[model samples]
Target chain A: MVETFGRHIRQSLGQLSYAAGFQLFLFKETFNFLGKRRIGLRVLILQILFTGVEALSIISLLSLGIGAVIIIQGAQLPDFLLGEQLYRILIIVIARELGPLLTAFVIIARSGSAITTELGNMVVSHEMEAYLSVGIHPVSQLGVPRLIGMSISMFLLTVYSNVFGLLGSLTVSSIITRVRLADHLSALFANFYLVDIVASIAKSFVFGIIIAATSVYYGFSVSGAITEVPVKTIRSIGVSIVLCVIADGIIILLTMLVTA
Target chain B: MIDVPIVLDDVTIRFDGRAALDGLSLEFQRGKSTAVIGSSGSGKSLVLKCAAGLIFPEEGDVLFEGRSIATMGEREYQQMQARTGFHFQDAALWANKSLGENLSLPLLAADPDLSDYALHGKVAESFASVKLELDPSLRPAAISMGQQKMVSFLRATISRPEILFLDDSLSFMDHAGSRQLMARIEEFKDAGATIIIATHNREFSGRLADRVVVLSDGRMVASGPYQEVMSSQDPALLPVLRDLV
Candidate 1:
C-alpha cells in the first residue's frame, strides 16, 4: 500500500514536471507563431474574449460588494483614526491581497474548467490525433493561445478588480464619512504605493500560469475514453483551485519578505 | 519532400499486457501501393498507424528511408507530416471545425502562404472532386456518416500528400461514394503517392494493391507480390487469405 502511494506521488510529480516544460515550450512557440500566423492570433483573441470580457460582470459585482462592506465597517473606528484606517485597509485588502485571489478563484471556477472540458472532449473525439496527422502541433496551436490568453485575462481582471474595488469604497466613504473630500482623496492616493500594483501583477501572473497549465495538461491527459473526459475535468478543476490558493499564499509571503 | 520507402523493423505494440502487433516487420516501397488485410484483432490498422508515425513500437523502429522516425528532428517530422495524409476508420473529422475548416487546415498547414481566395478555390475544387454539395459551414456532427467519411477523404487528399494512409476508409461510403473515392485514390496513385491502406474489402485491395500483407493474431502470415500471395498453398496462410484468394 505504501509502495502504491509512493508510485502515485511519483507519477503526479512527473506529470507536473512534464506539463511545466510543455507550457514553457508552448509559450515560445505560440509567440513565434503569433508573428507569422493569423490563425493563431485569431484563436488568442477569442480566448481573451471568452475568458476576460465575458467575466467582467461577476468580477465587478463581487469587488463592489467587498469594497462597500470594508468601508461601512471601518466607519465604526474612532473618528480621528477612521479616515486613515479606511484608506490603508482598502489598499491592503482590495489591492494587495483579495483582488488577485478572488479574481483567480473566479477564473478557476470558470475558464479553467471550461478549458479542461473542451480539450478533454477534443481528445475523446480524436481531434488531437487529427491535428497531429495534419502537421499541426496541438500544444503550439491550442495550448499557447490559452496560456497567453488566461495570463493576459488574469492580469487585466486583477487590475479591473482594483479599480472597481477602490471606486466602491470611495463612493461609500463619501456618503457616510464627514471627512473633507480633499483629505480623503489625498489619503487614499498616499496609502496606495507602486509596490501594491506590482504585487497584484506578480500574483495574477503566477496564478494564471498555474490555472492555464493545469487545465490544458488535464485536458490532454484524457486518453482513449469518453468517460475519462469528466474525470479529467474534475481533476483539473480541483488541482487548479488548490494550486491557485497555494500560489496566492506564497506570493503574499514573498512580497511581505521583500518589502520588509 | 518525404523520403520513401517506410520500413518497420520488428515492430511490437502492446495494450493492457496483450500485444496488438507482435514482432511484425514490413517495408513499403516508393511510388507503390500496399494493402494490409486481417481479421478483427489482427493489427492491420496498427501497422498503418505505426508506419504513419502516429504510434511508436515497443520492440523496434519505423524508418522513413534509413532514418528512424523515433528520433527524427522536428523540422523533418513536420515535413513528413505535411507530405503525408491519413484517413481514419471512423472519419475522425474535427468536431468543432466546419467541413471547410477541416479541409482548409491541412491545406493551410502544408502551405500557409496560400491566399484565402486560393484556399477557397482549392476547397471548392476538392468538394467538386467528390461531387459533395454540402455546405462548407456544416460541422461533422451535422453531416451523415457517409458524408463525414467523404469530407474526411477530401481533407486527406486536399493537399495531395505524397504518402497516404487510409484505414477502412470506405466503411461508411455507398456505392457511388466509394467509386468517387476509389477514382480519386487512382489519381493519387497515378501521381506517384505511396498508398497504404487497412481494409477488409478484398476486391478493393485486389484491384489496387501491388503487394498484400495478411495478418493473423498480430503477426504477418503472408506477404508478397499480390498474385503470388493469393495463390500460395501454405496451410497457415489459407484461413486468413480464404476470401481474398
Candidate 2:
C-alpha cells in the first residue's frame, strides 16, 4: 500500500513538472514566432474583437454598478467627510484592484474557455497533426497571435473599466450629493496617481498572458479523445483563474513596496 | 526539392505506459516506394510520424539525409518540413478554415511570397490531379467524408514534396475516389518521389510498394521486397497477406 501511494505521488510530481515545462516552451516558441504571426494578423484582430470589443457592454455595466455601490455605501461614512474619502476609495478599487481583476475575469470566462475547447477539439480531430505534418509549428501558428491579442485587449479593457467606473461614480455623486461634475473630477484627480495606472496595466497584462498560455497549453494537452476536450477546458479555466489571482497578489505586493 | 532517405534506427514509442512501437527499425529509400503493413494499433502510423518528426521516438533516432533529426539546425528542419508531406489516417482538415485557407497554409509557409493567383492555381491543379472540383470557400464540414479525405491528400501533396508519407491513404473513399487517389499516388511514384505508405489495403501494397515492412504487435516481424516477402510463406506473412487480403 505504501509503495503504491509513493508511486502515485511520483507520477503526480512528474506530470506537474511536465506541465510547468510546457508553459515555458510555449512562451519561448511564441517569442520566436512573433514576426511570423504578422502574416495572420486577421486572427489577432478577431481575437481582440471577441475578447475586448465584444465584452465592452457587460464590462461597462458591471463597472458602473460597482462604482454606484461604492458611492451609496460611502454615504454611510458619518457625514460631509464622504466626498474626500469616497474619491480615494474609488481610485484604489477602480484603478488598482477591481478594474483589472474584473476585466480579466470577464476575459477568462469568455476567451480562455473558448481557446481551450477549440484547440482541444483540433487535437482530437488530428488537425494538429495535419499542421505538424506540413512543418508548421502550432505554437507559432496559433499561440503567439492569441497571447498578443489577449494581452493587448486586457490592458485596454482595464483602462475602460477605470474610465467607465469614474463616470458612474460622477453620475451617482451628482444625483445623491448634488455635487457638481467639476468637484468630483478634481477630487478623483487629486487621489489618482501614476502608480495606480501602472499597477492596473501591469496586472491586466500579466493576467492576459496567464490566461492565454494556460488555455492553449491545456487545449494541446488533451490525450486524443473527444471526451477529453471538456476536461481540459475546465482545467484550463481553473488554472488560468488561479494563476491570474496569484499574479495579481504578487503585483499588488510589488506596487505597495514601490509606493513605500 | 531533392529526395533523401528516412531511416528509423530501432525506434520505440510508448503510450499510456505501454510500448506502442518496440525497437522498430526500417529505412525508406530515396526515389523508392515502401509500404508498412500491420494490423490496427501495430504502430504503422507511429513509424510514419516518427520519420516525419511529428512524433519523436522514445529510443533511437530518425535519420534524414544521413543525419539524425535531433542534430539538424532549425533552417534545415524547416526546409525538410516544407519539402516532405505526410497524409494522416484521418482527413484532418482544419474545420474552421475554408478549404482554400486550409490548402493555402502550407503553400504560404513554404513560400510566403506566393501570389494569390498562383496559390489558387496550385490548389486547382491539386484538385485537377484527382479529377475533382471542390469549392475553396466551403469549410470541410460542408463536404462529404470521401471528398474531405481527397482534399486532405491534395493538401499533403500540393506542395509536391520529394518525399511522401501516407497513413491509411485510401480510407473513407468510394471505389472511384480510391481509383483516382491510387492514380495520383502512382503519378507521385513515377515522378521518383520517395513514398512510404502505412496501410492494410492489399492493392496499395501490391501495386505501389517496391518493399514491404510487416509489423505485428509493435515490432517488425518481416521486411523485404514486396514480392519476395509475399511469397516467403512465413507464418507472419500468412497473417499479413491474408489479413490484408
Candidate 3:
C-alpha cells in the first residue's frame, strides 16, 4: 500500500513538472516571436476570425436569452425584498460574472477543441517533426499567434456579451414593467463600476491564455494513434474550464478586496 | 577524400525499457549517399533520426560537422537545421496549408527576404522536376499518396539543403516514379549534398548509395559498399541480406 501510494505521488509530480516546463517554453517562444517581429500575421488574423468573429452570432443570441431570463426572474421579486437598486444586481451578475465566464465557455467549446484536435493530428502525423526539421519553431509559428488571438477574442467577446445582455434586459424590463428605456439605461450606467469592467476583462484575458496554452499542450502531448485526438480534445476542454473557473474565483476575490 | 559531415558516437536510445539503438557508432562521409537497411523494428529509422538531431540518443553524442549537436545553442542548432532537410516516412505535410504554401513557408523561414515571385518560381521549378502538375491551392488531402510523397520530397529539397535525410520516402512510388525521383536526388548529390536514406528496397539502395549499413536488433551487423555487404557471409547479416537480394 505504501509503495503504491508513493508511486502515484511520483507520477503526479512528474506530470506537473512536465506541464510547467511546457508552459514556460510556450511563454518564452511567444516573447521570442514578439521581440523578433516573426509574428506570422496571416495566421494571427485567421485565428481572430475563427475564435472571435465567427463566434459573434451565437454569443449574442445566448447573451440576449440569459439577460431576458434574469430580468424576468428579477421582476417577480418584491421591491421590499431587494430594495430599489435592482440594476445593481443585474450589473453585478451579468457584467462582473457571467459575461466573461460564458464567453470563455463558448470559446472552449468551439476554438479550444478545434485547436487541440488539429494540433493532435499534426503531432500524430509527424508534421511537428517536419516543422522542427525545417528550423521553424512550432511555438512561434503556431502557438504565439493562437495565444494572442484567443486572448484578444476573449476580451472582445466578453464586452460584446455585456452590451447585448444589457440591451436585452432593458427591452424585456420596458415591455414587462412599463419602465422607460431611458430609465433602464440610466440605472445600468449608474450601477456599473470601472472596477467591474476591469475585473471582467482581466478574467477574460487570463482565461484566454489558460485555454490556449492548455489546448496546445494537450494537443502536442498526443503520441502514436489517431484515437488520442478526441481524448486530448476532451481533456483540453475539461482542464481549461476548471482552470478558468479557478482563475475567475481568485480574480473576483481580489477585486472585491480592492473595492472594499 | 571528402570530410565526414555526421557522426554518431557510441549512441544508445531506449524506449520503455527496450534499447532501440545499442552502442551504435558510425560516420557518414560527406558528399556521398549512405543507405541504412534493416528489417522492421531493427532501428534503421532511429539511426537516421538520431543523426539528423531529430532524436537525441540516451547515452552518447551526435556530431554534425565536428560540432556536437547536443551542446549547440538554439541559434546554432537552427542554423545547422537550416542546412539539413529530412523527408519523413509518412510524408508529413502540413494539413492546414495548401501544398504550395507548405513549400513556401519553410523557404521564407530560412530566408525571409525572398520575394513572392522568386518563391513562386522556386516552387514551380520543384514541381516541374517531379513532373507534378497540380493546383498549388489544393491541400494534401486532394492529392494521391504518390503525389503527396513527391510534394514532401520537393518541400525537403526546395531550398537545396546541404544534408538530406530521406526516411523510407520513396516506398510508395513505382519503379518508374522511383527512378524519376531518384534522378532528381542524383542532381542534389551532384551538387554536393550529403544524402542518408533508410530503406528496405535493395534495388533503390544499390542504385544510390556508395556505402550500406545493415542493422539487426539495434546493432550494426555489417557495414561497407552495397555489393560487399550483400556478398558478405557474416552469419547475423546473411539472413536479412538474402531476403533483400
Candidate 4:
C-alpha cells in the first residue's frame, strides 16, 4: 500500500511538472503577447466581438425574463411588503447575483464548453506539440485570446444583463403597478456605489478567468480520442460552475467584511 | 556532402529506471532515407521524438544541420520545425478542422507571410502530389483511414520540409496501399528530402530503407545497408532479417 501510494505521488509529481512547464510556456507567450501592440488591438477587437456584441442579445433576453419573473412573484407578496421594498428585491437579486451567474452560465453553455472542446482537440491531435515545435507557445497563441475574451465576455454580459434587467423591472413595474421609470431609476442610482460597481466588475473578471483557465486545463489534460471531447467539456462545465459559485461567494463575503 | 542532416551523440533516455534508449549514437545523412525497425517498446518512437525535439535525452545532444537542438531557443526551434515534417501512426489530424485547414496550418505557422492564394496553391499542389483529393470542407472524421493518412502526408509536406519522419504511418494500410505510399515517400526522398520511417513492417522496411536500423531492448542490434542488415550473421538480428525475407 505504501509503495503504491509513493508510486502515485511520484507519477503525479511528474504530471504536475509537465503541466507547470506548459503553464510557464503560456506565461511567456502572454508576456510576448502583451508586448505586441497591434495584436493587442486585434485581440481587443476580437474580444469585443466575442464578448460584447455576441453577448448583447442573450443578456437582454435573460435579464428581461428574470425581471418579469421577479415582478410577477413580488406582486404575490402582501401589499405592505411589495409597496416600498419591491424594487430592492429586483436590485439585489438581478444586479448582485442572478445577472452575473446567468451571464456565466450563458458563457459556459455557449463559449466556455466550446473553448474546452477546441483546445482538447488541439491537444489530442498534437497541434500543441506542433505549435511548440514551431517556436509558438500554445498558451500565448491560444490561451491569451481565450482568457481575454472570456473575461471580457463575462464582464460585459453581467453589466448588460444588469442594465437590461433594471430596465425590465421598470417596464414590468409600470405595467403592473404605479411605479414610474423615474422612481425606479432614482431608487437604483441612490443605492448604487462605486464600490458595488467595482465588485461586480471584479467578480465578472474572476469568473471569466476561472472559466477560461479551468476549461483550458481540462481540455489539455484530456487523455483520449476525439470521442471524449463532450465528456471533457461536460466535466469542464461542471467544475467551472462549482468554482465560479464558490469564488462568487468568497468575493462577496470578503467585500462585505472589508466594507463592514 | 551537406554534412550530416542530423546527429545523435550518445543520447540516453530513461523512463522510471528503464532505459528507452541506452546511450544510442547515430547519424542521418542529408537527403537520405533510413528505416528504424523494432518490436513494441524497443524505443524506436523515442528516437523520432528526440529527433523532433519533443522529448529531451537524459544525456547527449541532437544536432540538426550541425547545431544542437538540445539548447536551441524558440526561434531556432521554430526554424527547425519549418524544415521538418512528421507523420504519426494514427495520422494525428486536427479533428476540429477540415482537411484543407489541417494542411494549411503548418504553412501558416511557419511562414505567416505567404498570401492566401499562394498558400492555397501550395496546398493544392501538395495534395496533387499525394494523389488525394481532399475536399476543402470535409472534416477528419468524414474521411477514410487511407485518406486521413494521405492528408497527414500532405500536411507534413505543406511546409516543404527538408526532413520527414514517419512513425508507423503505413501500419494500417493494405500492401498495395503501403507500396503506393512508400513510392510517394521515395519520390520525396528523390526530391532531396531526408526520410526516416520507424515501423514494424519488415517488408516495407526492406524495400524502402537505404539503411535499416534494428533496435531491440533499447539497443541497436544491427545497422547497415538494407541488404547487409537483412543478411547479417548476428544471432539477435537473424530473426528480424528472416522476418524481412
Candidate 5:
C-alpha cells in the first residue's frame, strides 16, 4: 500500500512537470498574441468596453449611494467631528481603500468567471489541441487578449470608481454638511501624496493580472473529458477567488508599509 | 492507382497502461478511399489522430511523405495542418457559435486575413456543398443532428485540405444523407486529395472504400483492396465482414 502510494505520488509529480512546461509554452504564446497589431488592438478595445466601462455601472451606483449616506451621517454628526474630518473620511474610504478593493471584487465576480470558462471550454474541446497541432500556440492566440483586456479594464475601472466615488461624496458634503467646495479641495491637496495614488494604481493592476491568470490557468488545465468541464469551472472560480483574496491582503500590507 | 501520402510505421499509443494503438503500421494513399474498420474498442480513431498530429505515439513514428510528423517544427506543422481536414467524431462544433460560425472555424484558424464578407461567401460555398442553408446567426443547439454533421463537414473542408481524416464522421447520417456526403467526398477525392475514414457501417465502407484495413486490439489484422480483403479474409474478420454485408 505504501509502495503504491509512493508510485502514484511520483507519477503525479511527473504530470505536474508536463503541466508546468505546458504553462510556459502558453506564456510564450501570450507574448506572441501581444505582438499582433490589429487583433490585439481590437481585443483590447473590447476588453476595455466590456471589463471597464460596462462593468463600472454597478460599482458607480454603489459608490454614489455610499457617498450620499456618508454625507447624511456627517450632517447629523455632533458638530465637533463634522467640521474638518468629514472630507478626510470621504477621501480615505472612496479614494484610498473601499474604491479599489470593491472595484477589484466586482471585476473578479463579473469578468473573471466568464474569461476562465471560455478558455476552459476551449481546452476541454481540443481547440487548444487543434491550435497546438496547427503550430499556433493557444495561450498566445487566446490568453494574451484576455490578460490585456482584463488588466486595462481593472485599471480604468479603479480610476473611474475612485473619481466617481469622490464626486458623489463631494456632492453630499456640499448639500448636507455645508462644507465649501474650495475648503474640501484645499484639504484634499494638503494631505494627498503621489505615493498614495501610485499604491492604489499598482494594487488594481496586480489584482487584474492575478484574476486573469489564475482564472485562465484553471480553465486551460482541464483534461479533455465530457464530465470534467463543469468540475474544471468550479475549481477555476474557487481558485481565482482564493488567489485574489491573498493577493489583495499582501498588496494592502505592502502598500501600508511603504506609505508609512 | 493512388500514391501513398501517409504511412504509420509501427506506431504505438498508450493511455494509462491501455494501448490505444499498439504497433500499428498502415498507409493511406492519395486519390483512393481507405476505410479503417474496427470494433468499438479498437484504436481506429487513434490512427487518424496520429496522422492529423493531434496525438503523439510513445513508440515508433508517423510519417507524412517520409517526413516525421512528430518531429516537424511549428512552420512545417502549420503547412501540414493547412493540407489536411479532420472531422471530429461528435462534430465538436462550438455550441456558443452559430452553424456558419462552426463551419468557418477552420478557415479562420488557417488564415486570419479573411474578411467577414469573404468568409461568409466561402462558408456559403461549403454549406452549399453539404446541402445546408443555415443562417449565419443560428446557434448549434437550434440545428438538427444531421444538419450539425453537415456543418462539421463544411468546417472540415473549408480550408481545402489535401488529406481528409474522418473519424466516425458518417455514423449519424441516414442513407440519403450518407450518400450525399459520399458524393461530396468523391468530389474532394477527384481534386487529388487523400481520404481515410474510420467507420463501422459496412454499407458506408462497402460503397465508399477502394481498399479497407481492419484493426483489432490496436493491431492491423487484415488489409487489401476492399473486395479482395473481404473475399479472402481470415476467420477473425470473415464473420464480421459477412454481418456487415
Candidate 6:
C-alpha cells in the first residue's frame, strides 16, 4: 500500500514537472516568434474576433444584470448606514474584483476550452506532425498569436465589462431610488483612483496569459485518443479559473500594500 | 559505391520499456529509393521518423550529409527540414486550412518572397501532376480519403526537397492511382532526391525500392537488393517474406 501511494505521488510530480517545462518552452518560443516578426497578423485578428469582439453582447448583458443586483442590494440597507458611499462600494466590487474575474470566466468557458480541444484534435489527427515536418514550429505558428490575441482581448473585455456594469447599475439607481445619474457619476469618478485601473488591468493581463498558456499546455499534452480532448479542455478551464482567482488575490494585495 | 545522404548509426528507441528499435545501423544511398518492410509493431515507421528527425532515438545518432542532426541548432535543423519532406500514413493534412492553404504553407515557409501568383502557379502544377483539378478552397473534410492522401503527397513534394520520406503514403489509393503516384515518386528520384518508404505492400516496394531492408521484432533481419532480400529463405525473415510472396 505504501509503495502504491508512493508511485502515485511520483507520477503526479512527474506530470507537474512536464507541464511546467512545456510552459517554459512555449514562453520562449512565443517571445522568439514575436522578436522575429513571425507573428501571423491574420490569425491574431481572427482570435481577437472570436475571443473578444464576439463576446461583447454576452458580457454586456451579464454586467448589466450584476450591476443592477449590487445597486438594488446596497439601496435596501439603511441610507444612514450606506449613504453616498454606495458608489465607492460599487467601484471596488465591480471594477476591481468582479470585472476581471467574470471576464476570465467567460473566456475560460469559451476560448480556453476551444483552444484545448482544437489543439488536442490536431494532435490526434497528426496535424501537429504536419506542421513540424514542414519546418514550421507549431508553437510559433499557432501558440503565439493565440497568446497575444487572448491577452489583449481579456484586458479590453475587463474594461468593457466594468463600464457596462457601472453604467447599468447607475441607470437602475436613477429609475428605482430617484438618485440622479450625475450624482452617481460624480461619486464613481471621485472614488475610482488610478490604482484601481492599474490593478484591474494587471489582473486581466496576467489572467489572460495564464489562461492561454495553460490551455495550450494541456492541448499539446494530449496524446493517442480523441476522448482526451474533452478531458484536457475541462482541466484547462478548471486550472485557468483557479489560477485567475489566486492571481487576483495576489495582485489586489500587492496593490493595496504599494498604495498604503 | 553510391554516396549515402543519410545514415542511422547504432540507433535505439524504447517505448514503455520495450525497445522499438535496437542498435539498428543503416545507410540510405543518395538518389536511390529504399523500402523498410516489417510486420505490424516491428518499428518500420519509427525508423523512418528517426531518420527524418521527427523523433529522436533514445541512443545513437542520425547523420544527414555527414553532420549529426542531434547537434544541429534550431535554425540549422529547420533549414535541414526545409530541404526534406515526409508523407504520413494518414496524410495528416491541416483540417483548419483549405487544401490550397495546406499546400501553400510549406512552399511559403521555404521561400516567403514568392508572389501570390507564383504560389498559385506552383500549387496548380502539383495538382495537375496528380490529375487532380479540384477547387483549392475546399477543406480536407469535403474531400475523399484517397484525394486527401494524394494531396498529402503533393504537399510533401511540392517544394521538391532533396530527400523524401513516405510512411505508407500510398496505402489507401486504388492500384491505378498508386501506380501513377509511384511514377511521380520515380520522377522525384530521377531528379536526384533520396527516397525512403516504409510499407507492407510487396508490389509497391518491389517496384520502387532498389534496396530493401526487412525488419522483425525491432531488429534487422535482411538487407540487400529488392529481389535478393525477398527471395531469401532465412528463418528470421520467413514470416515477413511470406507476405511478399
Best by TM-score: 3
lDDT tens readout by residue for model 3, A37-123: 533777888889999999999999999999889888877877711334777777888888999999999999999999999889888
Q: Model 2, B150-241: lDDT tens per residue?
A: 89988899899998999998898889999988998999999988899999998989999999999987899999898898888887568767
As for model 1, its CA RMSD to the true structure in angstroms is: 2.8
* Candidate 1 CAPRI assessment class: medium
| Fnat for candidate 1 (0 to 1) | 0.62
Runs off by more than 4 Å, candidate 4: A1-21, A34-89, A130-136, A181-183, A223-239, A242-260, B9-23, B57-61, B65-70, B172-180, B242-245
Q: Is the docking of candidate 6 incorrect, acceptable, medium or high quality?
A: medium
What ranges in model 3 sit over 4 Å off?
A: A35-39, A80-84
Per-model TM-score on C-alpha atoms = 0.91, 0.95, 0.96, 0.81, 0.84, 0.95
lDDT for each residue of candidate 1 in B66-139, tens digit (9 for 90 to 100) = 88988987678778888889998889898877899999988878778889999999999999987889899989
Distance (Å) between predicted and true CA of A8, model 2? 4.4
Task: Tell me how each candidate scores on DockQ against the true complex.
Answer: 0.65, 0.65, 0.67, 0.31, 0.35, 0.60
TM-score of the first chain alone, every candidate: 0.89, 0.94, 0.95, 0.86, 0.82, 0.94
Worst 10 residues of 4 chain A by lDDT: A35-44
Tell me the tens digit of each residue's lDDT in model 5 across A21-81.
8667656666676445443465567767888888877988977777667667666657623
lDDT for A153 (candidate 2):
93
Candidate 3 DockQ, CA atoms: 0.67
What is the C-alpha lDDT profile of model 6 across B1-245, one tens digit per residue?
33887899999999888999999999999888999999988999999989998878889999988889889887888898899999999999999889998999998878767789999999999899889978999999999888999999999999889999999977789877888888998898888888999999888898889899998888898899998988888887888977652
Which pairs clash in model 6?
A: none
> Against the hidden true structure, what lDDT does model 6 obtain?
0.88
Model 2: per-residue lDDT, tens digit, A1-260? 99999999999999989888887877887677655664557778888998889989999999999877777777677763354777777788888898999888889999999999998999889888888877777766777778888999999899999898888877887888787888888888988889988898899899999999888888888879999999898888888889889998899899989999
Error in Å for residue B176 of model 4: 6.3
Report, for all candidates in order, the number of backbone clashes.
0, 0, 0, 0, 2, 0
Binned by DockQ into CAPRI classes (incorrect, acceptable, medium, high), candidate 5 is acceptable
Give the total clashing residue pairs for model 4. 0
Model 6 misses residue B158 by how many Å? Answer: 0.9
Note each model's CA RMSD in angstroms.
2.8, 2.1, 1.9, 4.3, 3.8, 2.1
